[model samples]
Target: MSTATARSNLGNTIAAHAILITWTVIALFPVFVILINSLKTRKAIFREPLALPNAESFSLVGYQTVAKQGDFFLYFQNSMIVTVVSLTFILLFGAMAAFALSEYRFRGNSLMGLYLALGIMIPIRIGTVAILEMMVATGLVNTLTALILVYTAQGLPLAVFILSEFMRQVSEDLKNAGRIDGLSEYAIFFRLVLPLVRPAMATVAVFNMIPIWNDLWFPLILAPGEETKTLTLGSQVFIGQFVTDWNAVLSALSLAILPALVLYLIFSRQLIRGITSGAVK
Candidate 1:
């Protein structure tokens, strides 16, 4: 309100943005460098590392090599299927479990919530011994099913915890009104509660998607077979095999980055907008 106070606030805002921009540039510089050079020829890449790709220097040889040598489309499909299926399970099961914990105060409810949420702090990789044994015992070691199940287990705990917190803040009166309207508990969850918690759900979806899309561990450990390889795993293997081939490696990295960048751009506004909006409201 006072002139001095307003000026001080403005100065702080400027400093914050300066820091943020600086860090963002630092983070993005390598990615930009890799992507631009992926389009340039080998000589151009080394000679003009900081230069933009010109029409005369630009070439599509990297992309051609990647596509010709590998079944990129198949890997893309595998990733899409696994990500979608795993996310569906996480959202449905996580939301249902969260709803039960929030709406009903049954015995062991708090304890169970705490139990499940422990997975957030404890990396599931620590239990690789048991997970692999279980997968092997069940004959699912090299299957996409194995990857989906492991990711669901890995993602569910955090999903339930975040959604449960959001569910707790859902107005009790609306739930009561649904009960008074003769709706079953299941119907109430489907129509009343689920609709209200969608913002948090979007937040959870985006949160889970990035890790799953970018993951290398589960694919390598659980489903390393050629037939079951996800895009991330495929790209990694391809890059390693072609490490000395700068064009191929850079192109592979670019391809890997494209889908993730597109998805982030699409959902970023929604993920940030509603989660904070809900909290503020």
Candidate 2:
């Protein structure tokens, strides 16, 4: 650590932070616009779309409509159930499979890893018709179970890919020590490996959370029932073919953005570390 070397490191750190800040602003600019306009009068929204709401312009019509028109609480509950349950399964099963792939030396292991990783390259929506038929055959259509199953399938590929990489990076000597200490395989996985990959788990959760929360495709196709409708689909009541309700739309979007934003904030540190884990070291 010479003076010049320390100064260079400090400069690089500042540059990285500046780039991240700029990207964050660019990414969130649309959300900011929608939030501001959601609080404005319909007329004010169009007249001053980019401007902040003033006394005369401020209105709660959008939120009022959201409250009155649909079972928003139900929709929110449905979304929460679907997202949380799906993430739970994705993390649990994905981690297990990843642990197996990374920790074991079995025949066709490389092929199995490649097979699972293929999901990352291929779009799941390509099999939408097949999935729908399977769901229908099992009578899971129009149920939250249908949404959970579909989302779990959609998220697992990336989870396995990411988690396996992190799992492979875990210390083999530590795992061997756990084995010699009379720890069962499951105990070692649950107590040792999973904790060490917490950052990777957080990364996978955050990556999968937004898409599941904001998704309209599967919900519309698989579970369009009033009781099963997610927040994204339920917001469609405010949307029309010819005449759209801008206020209600913006208000719904603003509401929808909150959970994802909060989750990201909670996992922001772990997510960054997971993404950058091996790059520096």
Candidate 3:
């Protein structure tokens, strides 16, 4: 390559890196500000809002207030149960539906696929009244079960849509070989096909987990009780009650953000792998 051409390429690379770094800083600035403020005293927070918490300005009063007033462990437990259970159901049902749609030649298969896909565009909030009524009738109101059911329903469509695309790419020869070996369809799915599409499943689980963990609407409507409150709902309630107390509000928000951030950091590698693997295929 000519010197000028090499220089041009280097310039472009530099520009791209610069832009990415700028965007990263912009995105993380708010989180940095919130976290630092959470560690500072209210006076320091208001006075030097952007300053990091030094020894003189630092205080744990906000965390203490939160610990005293909020049952964070219970809220965390509720979130974990709801997220895990809902994700399990979403993955199981979505994988089954996706497998059926992708592998089988059945009547109205296209129509059924389209029907399921419709949920992707349509927001579930429209059916809140009906969902609430059903929950009430079933005596599930103000319970974790209600939240789990709702989240599973909300997540299943997108999960099925993503999984079905990946499932379709499974090798026909592999499936046939499984059948010839006396493997039942269920066995083929659980052993052969499911393992192959695990990356996609992980991607789906991570995608669905964010909404389920962060959702406030379903929890508020169906399971607003203290015992059933997810972290998101509990954080909101805590902040609202302590709105005047900036320290507690900041601490509550930091607590809320920390767990989700940690989870994403852990799963982000798999998420990127899933997307890239599909693209390569």
Candidate 4:
């Protein structure tokens, strides 16, 4: 290649990297501020908001206050329980429903698919009143089970929609071979189909699980009790009560953020892999 061409390519690469770095900083700056402020004393936080924690300014008082005032562990447990159970139900039922719609020709199959797909377009918040009323009537209000059920219902449509498309791409020959080997339809789905669609499921799970974990509305409305509070709701309530205390407020925000951040970092690779693998196939 000519030197001019090489220089032009190098300039473009540098410009691209500069833009990416700028965007990354914009995205992370808020979290960075919150985390750093959480570690500083109130005076230092107010005086030097952008400064990092130094020997003189460093303090754990906010975290100490948060730990003393809240059932952090219990709240964490509730969040985890609701997210995990809801994801499990969404994957299992969504996959089964998608597989049925994609692999078999039955009466009303198109209608069923349309009905399920409707949920993707409609926001679940529109049905909050009805969901709360039903939960109250069923005695599920204030229970983790209620959150799980609500999240599962909310997540199912998109899960089914995504999984169904992937299911349709599964080789018909492979399914027919399973049948020829005397495998039951259920066996074929559980053994062969499930494995084949694992990447799509992972993608769906990562996408849906974040919203479930960070949700505050359902938990606040339906399950605001001390035992049932999720980390998000708990942190909100805590921060509200201590809003005047900047350190405590920042600490609470940091606490709520770090788990989700860590989880995203952990599963981000799987999410990327799923997308790339599905694209390649």
Every candidate's lDDT: 0.90, 0.88, 0.93, 0.92
After superposition on all CA atoms, how large is the RMSD of candidate 4?
A: 2.2
Candidate 2 structure lDDT = 0.88
Model 4: weakest 10-residue lDDT segment is: 272-281
Structural similarity to truth (TM-score) of each candidate: 0.90, 0.83, 0.92, 0.93
Q: Give per-residue CA lDDT, model 4, range 1-281, as digits (tens).
A: 69999999999999999999999999999999999999999999999999999999999999999999977889999999999999999999999999999999999999999999899889899999999999899999889999998899999999998999999999999999999999999999999999999888889998898899989889999999888999999998998899898878998899999999899899989878866766323
The order by descending lDDT is: 3, 4, 1, 2
Give the clashing residue pairs of candidate 2, or none. Answer: none
- How well is each residue in 156-264 modelled by candidate 3, as lDDT tens digits? 8888899999999999999999999999999999999999998888989987898899998998889999889999999999899999999999999999999999998
Model 4 stretches astray by more than 4 angstroms: 1-7, 273-281
lDDT of candidate 2 over 1-281, digit per residue (tens): 69999999999999999999999999989989989999999999998799999999999998888788767789989999999999999999999999999999999999999999898878889999999999999999999999899889889989998899889999999999999999999999999999999888888987788899989899989999888999888877445421378888888877777766887788788767766765223
TM-score (C-alpha, index-matched) for candidate 4 = 0.93
Tens-digit per-residue lDDT, 1-281, candidate 1? 69999999999999999999999999999989988988999889888898989997798889999999877788899999999999999999999999999999899999999999999899989998889899999999889999899889989998998899899999999999989999999999999999999988888887788888888998999898988899999999999899998998889999988888889889989878756765323
Q: Sorted by TM-score, highest first, which candidate order results?
A: 4, 3, 1, 2
Q: Residue 124 in model 3: shift from native, Å?
A: 1.1
